[model samples]
Target: MLSFNILYSQERNVYDENIFVNCQNEKLNWKKLELNSTEYKYTLISKNYFASDKDVNYYNGLIILPIDKNEENKNVIEELLKLISIEEDLFEITAIKKCEIQKLYYSSFLTEEQKIEVKNNVIGKLRLGIKN
Candidate 1:
């Protein structure tokens, strides 16, 4: 498991290099986002554990999740989202999206032709074909 370390120190507020994505068909990768000023790290710990593609269930806002059960990670997640703009070095130029996240997630980390599959997935481009 690669660590992005978006949160670091006791404050849990920092970024580390080589933050890889989870692109396996059986594993999931998650990230941070802010909605209604509430922070959430979109990890496989959400509600989409039993479904896929057309059968997948989105959050209350049509957002998909895998575990969706960590209430305490809210504010910390939001702060992580905010870190994108604060630290340009936090994430790749495309994946972070200037900190405007909407249902943030992606696949595993794989580098091909100098392009990362996970980064492409995060960018919402390239057809990895694996859905949900």
Candidate 2:
């Protein structure tokens, strides 16, 4: 007899059960599906809260680093000084240089002209103060 039998199977939903046992024998189920649904919507909204441009994203932090202190080819100090043009506080500039010199973290975020202008401004300020 060539007879075919159809098998019946049901997909189990996680929310359908309170069979999970806690230490105190308490059973828990996904009773609040609405809360979970709202949570998903909230997540989607929150994701774009910290979104940023792709161009500025690559240099978001000091992810790449030099491992050797004596790596003579690394121009981290030069780059740090160059970028000091954008830094307002001397302490902040010093901190950036400190990280580079001590930890091998490196960054270069400014053009040569910017560095020259900054250096010139500092020199001009000193000269003006000295002349007065």
> TM-scores across all candidates?
0.21, 0.16
Candidate that scores best on lDDT? 1
Deviation (Å) of 20 in candidate 2: 35
Residue-level lDDT for 85 in candidate 1 = 28
Task: For candidate 1, write residues 1-120 as lDDT tens digits.
Answer: 211112111112221112332233334345665556855443322121222356332221111222222456444444543453243233212222222222223222334521332332
Residue-level lDDT tens digits of model 2 in 1-132: 111111111112211111111111321111111221331000000001122343221111111111233346235433433233222111222222222223211113223443332221110000000000
lDDT of 1 at 90: 30
What candidate 2 gets wrong by more than 4 Å, as runs, is 1-68, 71-76, 84-91, 96-132
Worst lDDT window (10 residues) for model 2?
123-132
